[model samples]
Target chain A: MNIVVIDYGMGNIRSIQSSLLYLGVKSVIVSSDRNDILKADKIILPGVGAFGEAVREIKKRNLEKHLAEAVLKDGKPILGICLGMQLLGLSSEEGGFNKGLNFVNGVVTKLYGEGIKIPHVGFNQIQVNENSRLYNGLNSEPDFYFTHSFKMTSEDDIGASHCVYGSRFVASFENNNVAGVQFHPELSQNNGLRLLKNFIERF
Target chain B: MLRKRIIFTLIHSDGYFMQSRNFRLQKVGNLLWLEKNYKFQHISFSLDELIILDATRNQKNLSQFASIVSGVVNDVFIPVAAGGGIRSLADADLLFKSGADKIVLNSLQYENPLIVRELVEKYGSQSIIASVDYKSTAEGHLVYVNDGSKKIEYSLKEYLTYLEDLGVGEIYLNSIDKDGTGFGYDLETILNVKDLLSIPLIIAGGAGNEKHLLEGLKTDGIAAVATANLFNFIGDGLPNARNHIISLGENIANWNANS
Candidate 1:
């Protein structure tokens, strides 16, 4: 299968490529090319850094349109990680009010609670949704590495899995072929690898 | 719940990985030797994060260190933070392109505040880690930079506040006296500064075994515990240590080994 990792000139793409290769994926291409993304069997959107800059880059490369067509219209399975996950939502409050890809019904904002740390960095256990394809074959409560200041919040039932740092927030969400994870599964060890494998096979 | 982390720090000088004692470097082996001994690909499964610092004292090369980092973290599936001579955005870009999820800054945090601000503005505070190396003295904890050669003006507490003000995501506090001693983490020092900052704290420099790891993790307000001792947790030492730490009922991430 052709696995295309969207490269919008941000975040670590090497680790995701390396992880796929380790999982016996023979063809994994990192590209921002529209054709490459459209032609792929599956897509992985990985990102880090500021939300405003990431959204601006995506729009600059016309990735916003291409991704919408591929994932929404074409019904191709796409997995967004970290800021990539936030990008799939409606908007983010990182720098200022910035719009996202809006694949999932959600909004991104800074995590707030009494006496909780900002940029919650470390591995934390996630309460996986029973119907989550990305969390299949994992423990009831699996751990994934998360590093972010802003988190996605939603009232819609997008099959969201929740994790509590200071308060409960969306850890991951799946809606048919469209999925997004707040944590970095590529950096989450065995459970991460397993999730990637599930996305490749199940999704 | 947000779980604590166990970080393994690799100190690289020139082309070889070194075993550091009180900030003094002793060459251990090359990349081949490191792979043969540590089996990082397999052992990385036991770790929450990996930090590789280019501790090359003289004539530091960014490209060379980036190559080593890229090569070592090939199949290792963990958040890797790399630094040691990152002066410009291009240098930070090189490491990010190479495979670093976050950039570690020590001297630059003090020497250049503009670049630090720019990096924070560009990559957000979470992508930058402020590494503080200090030694307990007769007067107080004295901060050091430039690979522990010179002492800075700020005390440990004052320096941490400076890093926080600079918008660094995390603080990597290492004790020069306790480093590589295998004695355990300087808990007293850690306690002194743990509650002072709002950002995540990663304490380094004196973990000898799994028990030390447990002690550090068990402490309140510590986000992570880091160790750069190359020989202490060799082979299955890390895996065993992690298993022991988990067995102690500490709140850590658990993965299915069979998966």
Candidate 2:
């Protein structure tokens, strides 16, 4: 399959590429070209860094429209990791309340609570929903690596998986062809690889 | 619940991975030796994270180190943090491009606070790890930089606060006195300074066995425990220790690799 990792120039894209290679994915392309997105069998939107800068790069590279077309119109299976996940939401309060792709109904904000830490790092377990396509074939309460200050949440269902850091928030969500995880599945162990395989095969 | 992490740190010097002790280094093997003996992929199943440091004592070439880092990181699906002589944003960027999930900063944290801030601004705090090496002296716990050779004036606690203020995502507190000694973690000192910062703190040095890992994991306020002792945790040593620690009811995450 032609799996394209959307390169917005702000992601740890190598790890995702390497992980896909380990899963026996052949013909993987890392590109910002719109034609690459148009030709991909699956789309992996991986990102790291601030929301404002990421949005700026995506706009500068003109990936926003192509990404929206592929995931929304073409109905290509798309998975967003960490900051990429936050970008799939409705809006984020990270850097002056910038807008997201609005692929899913959610809002992103700083993770804060009574006595909880910021920039939650390390491996943390997520409570999966019963009908989660992203978590298919994985064991219960699987742990995934997380390193971010902001998290996404919504009043809607959105096929959400929950993790409790400060309070309960969205760990991952799957909405038909669109899916996003607030953790690094590429860096996460077998559970993560299983999730990625599910995205490639089942999604 | 957020599980505590077990990180296996590989100390590299001049194109060879070494066994570090008391701030001194002893070459153990090269990359071929590590993969041939340990099968890093198999051993990685026993770990939540991995840290590779370039203790190259002389002028270090980051691109070469980055290529080595890229070599070790393939097929090992865990977070790898690499650094030692990262003097600029370009150096840190090189490591990240070569497959490092996070950049570990030491002397850069002290000598170049502005560059550290720049890294934090660009990568955000979560991508930067501040590595503070301290030796408990009669004067007090004093900070050391430049591969544990030069001593800085900031007290241990004082320096930690400064790193946090610089918006570092995590603190890698390695005890120069206890590093690779096989004794145990400096729990007393850990307890004293553990509560000072609200961010995640990974305590390293002197973890010889599963019990040592358990002791550190079982403690309060520590997010992770790291060991760079090659002799102690090579071969099946890491997997065995991880199993033993988990069976003892420690909170380290269990992997489903090759299951």
Candidate 3:
């Protein structure tokens, strides 16, 4: 399968690439080239950094337009992980009010609740939706590694899996061909591998 | 629900991985020996996170360490946090490119507050971990840096507050006295300072067995427990401990390793 990992010059791209390699994917490309991303069978948006800076880098590299065209227009399946997932939302409150790629219907905001630690790090159980294509072949409640302060919430009927830290937040969302996970599936072991396989084969 | 974590720390020095005791290092073996003994590709399934720290006391090599990180992370699907001698954005960038999901900082959190601020601004707090090594004294817990060679003025509590204000993502508290002793964690010290933390806390040092790991994980306010004792957790040791911990009802991530 032709899998292209969108690189905006941030986050651990190597780990994602290594995970794909371990999964026996023969054609995984980490590139920012417009044509490479547009022609891929699937695209993985992987990021680890501030939303504003990440969005800025994406815009600077002109990946925003191509990504919109590839995922929104052509209906290619896209998987956004961690900061990449947050970048799919309408906006984020981190690093001031920053706009996202708006591929999914949501707003990223700081996690607000009493007695919860900031940057909620570690393995947390997620309530996976039964019909979620991203969670196919997984257990009812799967655990994924998450390390983020800002979380996504939506008013629309976006199929979201919920995880509670201080409050309920969108851990992963499925909206047609565009899917985003707040956790790092590449680092989440077997459950993660299963989820990524579902995205690659079932999506 | 956010579950607790069991982190495995690997101490790399020069071209060999070392076993540390009371902040003193003893060379264990090279990367080949490590791969043969630990087989991280299999053991990583039992861990929630992996932290690799370069503890070379003299003439630390950044590129070589990065290469080792890159080599070991292959096929080992788990969050890897690498640090040691990361002084610049380029160094952090190199580690990220090499496969580090998060960068752990020690001396720079004090020596270069501005760079820490820049990192926080660029990567956000969740991508940076502040590692504080301390030794308990008559006055209180005294913070140490530079591989525990230099002692800083701030007490453990004061230093943690400083780190929090500096906007680090998490705090890794390691006890210099209890390190590698197998006596279990210094739970008293953790309880004393647990209330002062606003970020996630990872406690390290003196974990020699599964019971010790369980004791650390069962404590309230402790987010994760880390062990760097390689010889103690070799072969199927880690997987067995993980199964035991899960059977004991501690909430940790479970996955089918055979799958």
Candidate 4:
């Protein structure tokens, strides 16, 4: 499959590409080029930096418009990780009030509660949605590696897998071919690898 | 619940991975020897995270070190944080481009905090880890930098606060006295200073067995336990330790059969 990772000179495209390589996806491309996005069989939006800066880079490379066309219009499956997931939402509170692609009906906000840590960094358990394509065939409360400050939540049915850090936040969300996970599946051992495999096969 | 972590640390100096004892590095073996025996690729499945520190004492050739890091972490699908002698963003850039999910900072944390701030701004706080090596002296817990050679003025508590204010994601607190000793972690010191910062803390140095690891993880506020002692936990040592911890009901990650 032609899996093109959207690299706007900001995301950690290496680990995502390697994870796909390990999962037996032979043809993977890490590019922000319009042609690569247009021709991609699937797009993986992997990010490791800030939301505001990431949006700037995406717009700078013209990935914003092309990605919208490829995913929204063409209906190509896309998986967004961490900040990439947040960028798929409407807005976030991190790195100043930021805007996103609005492909999914969600809004990013800082996860807060009494005695809860910021940038919840570690392997946290996720309670996947009943019919999540991203979390298909997973055991209950499966663990995934999370390292971020802001999380997305929406009143709309986005088919989210919830993880409680300080409070309940969207660990992952799937709406048809559009998918996003706040945790780093590339870093989260076997369960993560399985999730990626599911994305490649089921999505 | 967020599960605690078991991290395997690889200490590289000159051209080989070394076993560190009280900051004195003993050359263990080359990458080939490590692969043949330890089988990090196999054992890493049981580990939650991996930290590769370049302890080259001399003026560090960053390209050579980055190459080593890239080679070591090619297949390990875990959070890999690499650092040691990183002075500029270019050096960090090389490491991250190679495969590092997070860039570790030590001397730069105290020597050049502005650059550290810039890294935090660019990579976000979650992408930077502040590594503090402290020696329990007569005065108290003292912080060290420059490959644990030069002692700094700030105490452990003071230094951590500085790092927390500076906005590094996590803390890798290593005991210089307990490193590679195989005795145990400095639990007294860990307990004494665990509440100083709000960030997740990964305690390293002197984890001899699975129980030592369990003791560190069981301690309140300790997020992860790391060991750089090669001979102590070589080959099946790590996998055994992980199973022991999980069987006892500690919250380390457990992969299924197909996984």
Candidate 5:
């Protein structure tokens, strides 16, 4: 099976690539090429930077249309991380306002004020949701690495892993072949590796 | 059932937030050598204690610092604490605005002396953490701040008593000589500080193994233990650190279950 990691210069591509290799999966880094998206068995859009930058890059490359058609029409599995996860939402309050991939019905909001931290950096616990293939065979309620300032508040809670900082936020969610993680799985330790391996094996 | 209290510290290299790097060393070929020798990723998702410090240690302009704090707290999943170059109530407020769970202040306690009491009045004692970095001096033990940039004349006893009077929540006690050493925590320091205050204290610097963690837990006044080496152990091509720590903790819990 051929796995393609999307490259839009807004992600931790090399680390994600290295992790896949560690999982014994041979994955190719895909660019803005239309043929590449259509050809791969699975596509991974791993991101690290701001939400607005990711949306702009996706639109600029016209890969947004290809991604929508591929996932909705072609039934390809696509996973997003951090900003990539926010991109799966319909919109975000990152800087001003911006549109997202809209694969999931959600909005990204910034964390602020008392009992709430903005970026929410470092390791945090993950409360596993029912029927989650992403957390299959792993111990329940494990710590996952995180680094971001925005979180997705989805309309529906499907394949959700909930964790509370100041308020309850979506840590990870899955709908059909589309899965999103607010934390970086590539940066997570053994549990993160298991998550990546699960995605490679099942997705 | 009691929920596991999670602690998060944001690790910063120089000024920019990074995974882990000691500040005392300078290597011309280190970055390139690191890239070539090992697979280094800047923000790996495996961290329990994340700490961010101003690499420059600039005390004045806190707006820029607050912006950095604002940028990191939204996505992280744990209790986040920040320390370094803080000197006033306004500085503490800026850190709070930026999303810090606890504002760790050291020299500011001595500089104004009344600021801790004022902060306790405004934000409560739990939010204020009096940070101390102590070292063995010719006279005795000296507590200092700014990563030991200046020496404070006050002894650990006097400082802890002063903070308790101010009603601060916890004491973040660090040892400069033991930092980045991995030798183990300064047990004597904990013993000495524990005698001075009834409030919770966190022991940082030189945590090398599970044995060290066990010792820290046994210490009287310690609330938690913090380490940069722990994160480096897992994400740094070693045998995944988080899994190892979790497994170690589980083993101890199980042993206690049988006992």
Candidate 6:
């Protein structure tokens, strides 16, 4: 299966590419071509860095429109990780009112607490909300690593997996072919591999 | 569902495990036994690349780190990477003998770029991870040593090229400005290095959330991104981050199939 990982001057691209290869699916990293985006069976908008910067690169490369069309119109599978996931929302309060990919209806806001710390790091449990193809072979609550301060807040129940940090925040969410998870499966353990394997098997 | 990779980090210290949490101090010896016991029970079940940083390995803690390495050598079978205060071929040798699968060299790369060539030649390119710790200075992001106290007037791109020419296989770019800040990694610095090299680059510092991980991964050539305080008894971080990634991978997998 061909997977195209969108790159826009953010974080490591090789780890995701390697993770895909390890899961037995080869992927291509593309920053500037429409053909590459159109040709791929699946599209992945992997991001790391600031929301504004990520948005700038996506728009700068002109991959944003094509990506939106592919996932929203064509029903092609697309995944956004970490900042990429946050970018799938309407806006984020990280720096300013930065607009996201708008595939899902929500706003990414900062975690509310002082002594609780800013970047919530380390391992925590995940309670699977409703049946998701993503949760295959997974128990109800599995330990997953997390690191983030800003999170997506939404009123729609069908679109998110909630995790309570100070207050419950959206951990994973999906809207039709468009889906986003505010986590890095690439860094998680067996649960991570299993998660990737499930994605590959589905493809 | 989305797919993800695994990265494990270790920090070694002589004094004690001094954390931001209530100024609690755990004796090194006592911590080692607990860590070792945890590894013995949990390691086999997970897929993670181990990263060991000898916080005090410079002069006093060398023997201590070596002993620690020996203790976990057999129990932890995954790839073990060691960093901190590595300056010479001799230091690299000690780490390798102690069963470090990969040796991370940081400040030494600046003192003498040729050391990178020598180490890579002896250990092969993959074994040498040239770590660069820098902070955003008024001048630029300056690489430094002695735990980011000393500053060197070198652009990150310049050092990347220098190390690349030296035949160093990988680079661990740590942003001192972001370290402990948990703001997320300095993607700008990581991208600068990623733009220049073909080698694997790991972005470190200021990873407060999975958002930082995603940002680090989005860089064109980054191989891995790491955070210290995230994995252990820090905030409710590591598990949430890992699980989120796993859920993301699962999301992509299912999305791919049905979509």
Best by DockQ: 1
DockQ per candidate? 0.78, 0.70, 0.74, 0.70, 0.04, 0.02
Rank by lDDT, highest first. Answer: 1, 3, 2, 4, 5, 6
- DockQ-derived CAPRI band for the predicted complex in model 2: medium
DockQ winner, 2 or 6: 2
Model 5: runs farther than 4 Å from truth? A112-114, B1-259
CAPRI-style class, candidate 5: incorrect
**Any residue pairs clashing in model 4, and if so which?**
none
Task: Tell me the interface RMSD of every candidate, in Å.
Answer: 1.2, 1.6, 1.5, 1.4, 12.4, 13.3
lDDT of 5 by residue, B10-76 (tens): 4443434433232352222223343344333333233344455554444444676666655554444
Candidate 1 TM-score, true structure as reference: 0.98
Fnat per candidate: 0.79, 0.63, 0.75, 0.59, 0.03, 0.00
- Please give the lDDT score for candidate 5: 0.64
Q: TM-score for every candidate vs. truth?
A: 0.98, 0.98, 0.98, 0.98, 0.56, 0.52
Model 1 regions lying over 4 Å from their true place: none
Ten-residue segment with the worst summed lDDT in candidate 4 chain B?
Answer: B250-259
Evaluate all candidate structures by whole-model CA lDDT and list the values in order. 0.92, 0.90, 0.91, 0.88, 0.64, 0.63
Q: Looking at model 6, how many pairs of residues clash?
A: 55
Candidate 1 C-alpha lDDT tens digits along B67-96: 999989998999999999999999999999
Q: State each model's TM-score restricted to chain B.
A: 0.98, 0.98, 0.98, 0.98, 0.75, 0.79
lDDT of 3 by residue, B1-259 (tens): 7889999999999988989999789999998998899888989989999999999998879999999999889888899999999999999989988989899999998899999999998888999999999999898899999999999999899999999999999999999999988888989999999889989999999999999999988888999999999989989999999998999888888875223
